[model samples]
Target: MEATQQGADVFFVLMGAILVFAMHAGFAFLEVGTVRHKNQVNALVKIIVDFAISTLAYFFVGYSVAYGVDFLVSAAVLDGSAEGSPFAKQGFDLVKFFFLLTFAAAIPAIISGGIAERAKFWSQAMATAVIVGLIYPFYEGIVWGGNFGLQDWLSESYGAAFNDFAGSIVVHAVGGWIALGAVVLLGQRKGRYTSDGRVVGVPPSSIPWLALGSWLLCVGWFGFNVMSAQSVEGVSGLVAMNSLLAMVGGILVALIVGKNDPGFIHNGALAGLVAVCAGSNVMHPIGSLLVGGAAGAIFVIFFNLCQNRWRIDDVLGVWPLHGLCGLWGGIACGIFGQEALGGLGGVAFMSQLIGSLAGAAYALAGGFAVYGALKLLVGIRLTPEEEAQGADLSIHKIGANPESEMAPR
Candidate 1:
């Protein structure tokens, strides 16, 4: 039985790795296609660098936080009468490690969109360490770790516990809030706002890249959502169907609102994927669809508000799709998750909300402190000349082949 369980876990872990691996291509296209062609190489480079840093961080700190200590240690810490696990076994250590690795990859991708055009590459690379190593794992352990003293109330109330099966909150919310912090500190991209304060439209240099990235992301999200089930039961099939429905719902709503904007449609699909990520584990297909559609609508409303009304320029709509949709997913879990899945007292909704809010706060505060300190110490933005010329040359050593753009500022 132990062997069988281990085998099953290995299969699920491997499957998830493949799915998560595909997300890199998705991010590569999504970001490169969205930014100006001058920055395409830099954008691609950021994805590779961030993923590399994330891999290291997850292997070290993330694994320890997410699945290190046995739950018994937690209980013993809380109640002296309880005995801790002497063997110190981690639950499917390999599986947990791989799962968190994907999560680590996702965070940098989320932040990359916000800082796309002008962020210092080294700064972003440094952030990958803080986020994957210290930030994400700390919060993830608080919510999902076996140790009870920290989140024991959750287990007591909701039988299996604070369930964010596929990381709608852990991965997406963390990414969203961190991105928000970076954008707020980094300020708007050059010429993003006119002299009169009107927002400028920053169009993509390559439509094919943008469209391809969005499509690949849509395909990769299937692993992001459904692989969490880790089983072939009726539940797995249902979750898969729900993911499809939610994507459709998001696309439909975005199309209606965007009408003439293909960009909106592309963003809407991504938003839907993020929205359904949290509750896809337990919700019915129709429920997942509703959650996804709602995420799309929220994107239109929130993204517009941040850009035009609030004057917060999120270059790639990260705040809306990841942050806000993650928020919605937390609340949706309260409404849709089964009581049986939750536990006893019926405060699963409240717990989910609390956990989500807590996660957001940590991301925002921690991100600001890190970015702010780094900005003051090493500088986070490029000089005006560098900004105009593109980060491909200034931050990275690579230069565009065009002789007209070869002069260093």
Candidate 2:
């Protein structure tokens, strides 16, 4: 039974890992569809390479920082070969690392959208290594790994521990806030803002691609949330239901608030999924719906606010979509997860509030520290000449469809 359980758990998590890993394609396509034709190649390259760099960083350093577990020991110990036979024990820890690595990798993926046009490729990759290996896992350790008694303190003081079933604040919020720092440093994409103060619109290159990306993410999210249970026995149908309701709510609200803009509609679905990540296991499906609706609306409102009002020029509005919605998800868990509000009810408003704030705060500091250091040391942005040339030709030496362009026009 022990051997069976261990192998079963490995299979379950490995499936989840594969599903969530596929979401990286969702990230790539979403960015490809959002950025202009001139920069499409950069978008595709960044997501894949960032994932690669994130894997290396997470495997070597980030996992240890977060969980205090190192694979430096003999393979027998790492694979639990001593417990049962090698096959029976399974390489479960390796697959668990794969699953968590996808989540950590998303921090750079989120930032990639915000700094799409202007960031230097190698600079960002270096930043990715630092973030995945160090900055992000530090907080991951605190919240999920229980490194410094933060969860214990929250539980003792407020009658509940801070709860994030997945990576709302841990992954999404941190990614968003960190993107804010990078975006602010990188500044607006050239010609994105005119000297006289009018906002210049740089429209999406491909709506069809964008829609496809959204669909991929929506499908993969079932694994992202439900498989967060990590064991078949721990899985809950409520999580699947809540994710569906939240996504539905996000789509509807975005359709209404965004005046049927396909961009908003696709992103609205993401908003809902982001918001539902924290509380999907505990919140009632109805509460999840409201949370999703709120997140969709928040994405539309703050995306506009960041671009037009704040002049942040976050290309894909990642800060609002992932950052703000993530923070909301964290706090909303406290609100909607209470028995009074129809959640399973071992959560506290104070703990959630504080935990959410702390996560965002730490992210901002880490972002500024990492990106700021890089800015001073190596420069994070493309030169104006490079920016005007577009990242495709400037960085990658080719456009996305060079053959057709070269042959005809």
User: Model 2 scores what on Cα lDDT?
Assistant: 0.94
Runs of candidate 1 exceeding 4 Å displacement? 1-5, 69-92, 147-150, 155-160, 230-235, 338-347, 397-409
What TM-score does model 2 achieve against the real structure?
0.98
Residue pairs with clashing backbones, model 2: none
- Model 2 clashing-pair count: 0
Off by over 4 Å in 2: 83-88, 407-409
Clashing pairs for model 1 are 158-342, 158-343, 159-342, 159-343
lDDT of 1 by residue, 306-341 (tens): 988888888888989899888788767766665454
**Candidate No. with top TM-score:** 2
TM-score of each: 0.87, 0.98
- For residues 36-116, write the lDDT of model 2, one tens digit per residue: 999999999999999999999998999999998777767787777766533235888788888999899989999999999
Residue 299, model 2, lDDT: 97
